[model samples]
Target: MNYEFTTVGALIGLAVAIILIIKKLQPAYSLILGALIGGIIGSGSLVTTVNTMVSGGEGMISSVLRIMTSGILAGTLIKTGAAEKIAEVIVEKLGEKRALAAISLATMIICAVGVFIDISVITVAPIALAIGKKSGYHKEALLLAMIGGGKAGNIISPNPNTIAVSEAFKVDLTSLMMKNFIPAICAVVVTILLSTMLSKKQGVQVTENDLEQKEDKNLPSFIQAVAGPVVVVILLALRPVASIVIDPLIALPVGGVVCALACGQIKNIREYAEFGLGKVVGVSVLLIGTGTIAGIIKASALQYDVVHILKMANMPAFLLAPIAGILMAGATASTTAGATIGAQTFAGTLIKSGVSALSAGAMVHAGATVIDSLPHGSFFHATGGAAGLEIKERMKLIPYEMCVGLTSTVVAVMTYVI
Candidate 1:
């Protein structure tokens, strides 16, 4: 075999270094360093690489702005007690005996609203942890259940992933939704039931203290506790189904602000406006960084390199689609990317190359969630941290998530294919 310093090899090396830096260095600084190194290695020239690196650096900031904004919005919602209201109100109706059902349904509804996964986790984790503390339930088990339900919403909803896949594959959203709906819904049902049974077997249940306030002194009324945030998120989420006219994005934030005002949570319209703008900051920053990274890789011709490797293999399209999705999921730490961009980009090729559509679709779904389960994922890290799981302990969730993801894919394929 010839020893070739291919562009792909350089990019991979760059990726490895970035991962190392992420673990060690501050996030903002590490991203910059990685992009600079990527430029140098990808171009094989110093001056030209520096120029490109500068451009990439600037672009990354722009992307970060968007992600940061979104994050801030999410953070604000949590701080303002809007998100908590939604969760508690939702759980109150479920009853204690059906806690699993309550948790799953709450997760599903929240996710379907097209909220970011990290935000959703942040919103839900505290409640889940509180429940675990109260019921003597294993925190990990309950966390997994919450994550499972969220993942279901992430995969199947007409959220970013669905739209991304649709744009990439040149397929209709409604059609793909129809195709994948059954398996996605079934996966949530089965996973929740299984998690609940396991929790029960483990003798997990939230105690009265865990479920109720201790002193009840100066405690907000339950209606006051839930009204604002629930109304906002629900109105926003329901915008599409409610009217034939309004844009969902506009509606979501608008509803959030209005609810804030109506609930007397906002002192004035200016505060409401600030809350909306501020809430988007952290999320906007994250999005920008991720988008810039994707852009830099694309600019450096990474996709072509991956495609070239594929050309050498005897892999058919069906397998390739799933495999592509899996890789994308791992790289991006996003199922949304896997379903929308990964599937759209590779699914059709796989189908044309003799892969069954159902199998390809199933693989896309499987790949999307499995990658999220990895310890490297932001979702995993955030949830684990919030729940007080050490890194070593966080590994425990991996096998379960993997098993669920793999099993779900297989079942999906079987449901559609044979």
Candidate 2:
């Protein structure tokens, strides 16, 4: 293979993938097509391209399994009413005067405990809408608050993006998450401030018609609602705190079981597991597609080109991960895909350039959060619809979302580089 041709092929392939995603193609298909184009151009062999794609996807099985297993916990929290219970408690404690902050913090806590960001938004939407109507806050403000909090929590959460980056960089998941703690907190603070200001400025209250009421049922006690996430956190913490190693693959399902037991929904564990699996299937496929792209890039000279460019510009080495992350996530409009592709493609280069694996992984994870909520991605639509916002209102929230993401990225850079 000609090194220069491989580099150009890799770059073009990535560009083509981004274009496809922007054109409304599903991420999985876009990534796979791009990988094929790049591999064929780089190696000039059909068999080799297929082989590379398969090999790349095959390597992601562990990550895929971990993501799938995490569904168990997600399902338990969402289905058993624990997540709602948790949100309700937070809102009640804070009261209407602090509704924006309460909803933001509620979504953050829900997502930080391993719930998917989209699911977290959906789970908290009703509560946020209800609070908004009562507090005279704009619908846009409440939605933005949820998005900001979810993004903040997602950076340090045991979510798919974190899992993919950890595996890509060969870093301890818990350690990488710990490294993101300060940045996540900073993002939360930024979210609170921005949301509060937006609410005050707009004052276009959500109407009663916008509220979606859930069926009346007895919610699990606050203690029960908190128990599952607490158990998972303890298991994950044991690795760094006590020299015990429990993979997220094990800890997540165990936490789900604990959550179910505490919530008295253990009898319906199978149903919850199925529900969780359904939610994750799409993302699982997207990750495999991302892996194929990563493999093609890794096999090319693109990393060398990037390094040379950075050196010529005299930029700090730590900026590489974040730059890649922001670009990819902005292009794809999906944080996990962006973070995974960036980490897998550039982690080796970042490590070779004298950056530690944990730092590289943490930086990339934080960077992806910056633009993952762009309009092109499903998250933008899913979350907006969940919050009952129309296309125009949803569009208005982009800058604020970016601000929250930027806060996390800047904090990551300051913490890990200079």
Top candidate when judged by lDDT against the true structure: 2
Per-model root-mean-square deviation over C-alphas: 6.0, 1.6
Distance from true location, Cα of 4 in model 2, Å: 8.9
Separately for all candidates shown, the number of backbone clashes (residues 3 or more apart, or on different chains) is: 37, 0
- For residues 1-418, write the lDDT of model 1, one tens digit per residue: 1112335634664475458534755433444455556655564465655554455445444323333333323433444555556666677787665666677667765665445555676677667767667556676677667777777666654445544454345444434444565666766786676677667554334444434343433323445544444554454334345643333344345544544554465554455456546645533443333333343454555545565677779533345555666665665555653344355445545666676664565567655776655655466788676556678766766776665565556555666456
Cand. 2 TM to true fold: 0.97
- Residue range 206-320, candidate 2, lDDT tens digits: 7777887657778899999989999989999999999999999999999999999999989999999999999899999999999888888877888788888888999877789
Runs off by more than 4 Å, candidate 1: 1-7, 27-32, 43-80, 133-136, 156-183, 200-249, 266-280, 300-302, 308-314, 318-322, 331-366, 405-418
Give the C-alpha miss distance for residue 260 in model 1, angstroms. 2.0
| Model 2 residue 105 CA deviation in Å | 0.7
Q: How close is candidate 1 to the true structure, as a TM-score?
A: 0.69
**What ranges in model 2 sit over 4 Å off?**
1-5
